[model samples]
Target chain A: MAYIPSMDLVPGVLKGDTRAVARLLSRAENGNEEGRPALEEIFKRAGRAHVVGITGVPGSGKSTLVAKLTAAIRASGRKVAIIAVDPSSPYSGGSILGDRIRMGELVGDKGVYVRSMATRGALGGLARGTLEAVDIVDAAGYDMVLIETVGVGQDEVDVARASHTTVVVSAPGLGDDIQAIKAGVLEIADIHVVSKCDKPDADRTISDLKNMLVLSLGLQPHVPAPLDVGARKAARWQVPVVPTSSVNDKGIEELLKEIDRHGRSLKESGEIVERQAAIAERRLVKASEEMLRDKLEERRGELSVLLKELAARRVSPHYAARKLLTESGFGGDK
Target chain B: MSVAQTKADRIRVIVAKVGLDGHDRGVKIVARTLRDAGMDVIYTGLHRTPEEVVEAAVQEDADVIGISILSGAHMTVFPKLLKLLKARGADDIKVMGGGVIPDEDVVKLKKMGVAEILLQDTPPAAIVDSVRRIVAERGAR
Candidate 1:
């Protein structure tokens, strides 16, 4: 299959050509080789957009809140791009219900670019291509990039590591209170939102989250050194549990203000640089691992032969691996 | 070819609704069926224009563009879509349609380069099969 050259696409992407941006994102999602150089070229132009990740249980009104937030962001004269990651069908590797329907009105708006991504069988609720897509949007000069995850609890926490600020969305009466207690979800929240506040139980959910945050923060003092250090510093900015109802457009302004507050806190506290450094580190490590895996897969034939020998008990698995490594020049002259 | 091989080479289809038709229930069902059948389906939610549909198809590199129009505007929408696809150099993308389409218009749509036209009553299984067949034919081409 012939791919579009990075030379042709990178300029268009940098110029904010929507078509070019979409094609580059597709290439990234499919892992096309040409996307790498384009991404590399655009990486320097990124880091301007604020990346926010919103995640919650399946019916927690996450998309509606995203739609509201996108409008609020646009009202402030800032361009926004949304990456809604939906779960792919395990059988077909495709998705049916995307976040597009909830946020359809934003589709035709020039200031907004909405893209739906399927998890593509990735274990994490966020697709493998999500971060890359976010970067492309950022390079295209979007002021904010909101990533909405599939809300499968722990697996979705990867979004926290990907975004500058993570918003954990919950709703009253959806057993979302129980779902939020799943450890990874609550620990990652810089902002806690209790959506569907029109319901009677909304305040209860809000209080429950506040209580949980208090408990989690209380326990942070006992956490180990380096890990607790960031938490202790981040703890200065209290995690606000805001109640919102998209149905009535309630608390949206408050949520937006809280988001701005968090952004400001991160910048003032110098956590923004640290967060970006951590993100870069993670990206580098992931890329290196992928490269090593590809190199090993290229030697699959030799590995399979060794696997057969091991199956026949001719050699132990460890010995076979060591011999293969040595033969492949990876054992460093041993 | 094995089922695994066929699935690995999954067909990517964009199931779109053009004009002001809000009756996407059928299209959604078809999208689900095609997805279940192992084709990557991108559903451009309701009220899309022909230009938007073609642009999305081009960017997505979709194998098929299935337009589900219920608004009696199929005559205008389908031809406009064909023209847009040709103008954008995306004539290689197969076009299909369903929902409230009459029998006589079906022939016109086919002549205008629609790969298949399913009536409102067409079964989900048939929709899935026709898409697979059309994509296979395109592959042969």
Candidate 2:
């Protein structure tokens, strides 16, 4: 069967058709070529939603925190979409996405849309299709888009590059405070949340995070280099460590406020535009790489012949690669 | 909006447990089996209501909704789910189920729009084959 892009998909997505939105995301996740035009149509309508990324170690209650945050965002009369990226099973290429279980409360709410995406071997603790899915949700007019990573510690920093505000989640009693410092999650955090703060050692965890933040800030405040020459010099932002216990419903309101405060700071510092530009750059680079990969695969027979020649010591590996590049029209000059 | 046609890609399935059933060992295994068969399976975790399950099926555009209920609430959960799916115009989604269901209840559930019911003894490969057959039947329609 010839693959035909769904004719109504772009229109249906704009009309807030949930099924169409899901279909579009599936196409992107599977790397379907037909999804490109739909994405192009959706991209112009994006950039309105605030994309927040939540990442933490497994069992840090990241899903619970996301559920609470979604509720809080909904309470403010804004629509929210959540993309929970789960690790895929290497044996089957399938994922047991249980994040939605913790987020059960938000299931029937029309204002909330939750999707579970598989990492599909992208290896950066996020599904390769996440950015496109976010764009689909954004175009569908959601007010906030929350991306919860697979939370494999340092590898989750990809979310920092993809989101406007990256909230790093942690919990007490797991030694995550030290782990966070060691894993450098503290460096990428716009807001650090210590979930399950009702535990006996919650206070100690909170204090540990506070001390580490202070030490890190004093030693060397990690900041991305400004992309633009006229970027505003804003005040030094303090990474607030908020203690939250979802069981007790404690500190959720404070956490929301801190997120808002960080958003405001980004806007005031003119960093939001810079961040969006960086995200766009990343997307373009990824798309170009994917196209190059596809082209190489289309020429797999020739590439295999070149590889065999190199393996037989008939030609240098670099020379074969340059020849292939030139033949593929990518080399600047022959 | 026009009905979205099924792509030639892998079939998508949503595996869920409704009501207070916390025993998900059976459903998790089924989900893995379907996924290994090259299907995209979305497991909606545990303790979901019929409404939540139907909502997920609709939002996911799943070709199948496989429920694993061990709480013996098959009569309540299955019928309610059928009614909800009908009400939401999601009749195209095929519903299959398993996990400790009585023989009599399985017959009744089939009459109430449940497509297939696997018993506890059904092998994982059989479950995968059943899903493929159901998806193929649906696509043919």
Q: Where is model 1 more than 4 Å wrong at Cα?
A: A1-3, A176-182, A225-230, A292-334, B1-11, B18-25, B45-63, B80-94, B120-141
- Candidate 2 reference-contact recovery: 0.38
Task: Please state the i-RMS of candidate 2.
Answer: 8.8
TM-score of each: 0.84, 0.88
Candidate 2 to truth, TM: 0.88
| Residue lDDT tens for model 2, A143-194 | 8999999966654577877888888887788774456454355567778898
Which model scores highest in TM-score?
Answer: 2
i-RMSD of model 1 (Å, 1 decimal): 5.3
Task: Please give, for residues B1-141, the per-residue lDDT of candidate 1 as tens digits.
Answer: 112211134577888888888988888888888888877788878877787777767655577899988889999998898998888766778899888888889988898789999997888889989998998877621
The alpha-carbon deviation from the true structure for residue B52 of candidate 2, after best TM-score superposition, in angstroms, is 0.7
| CAPRI category for model 1 | acceptable
TM-score of candidate 1 against the unseen true structure = 0.84
Best by lDDT: 2
Clashing pairs in 1: none
Clashing pairs in 2: none
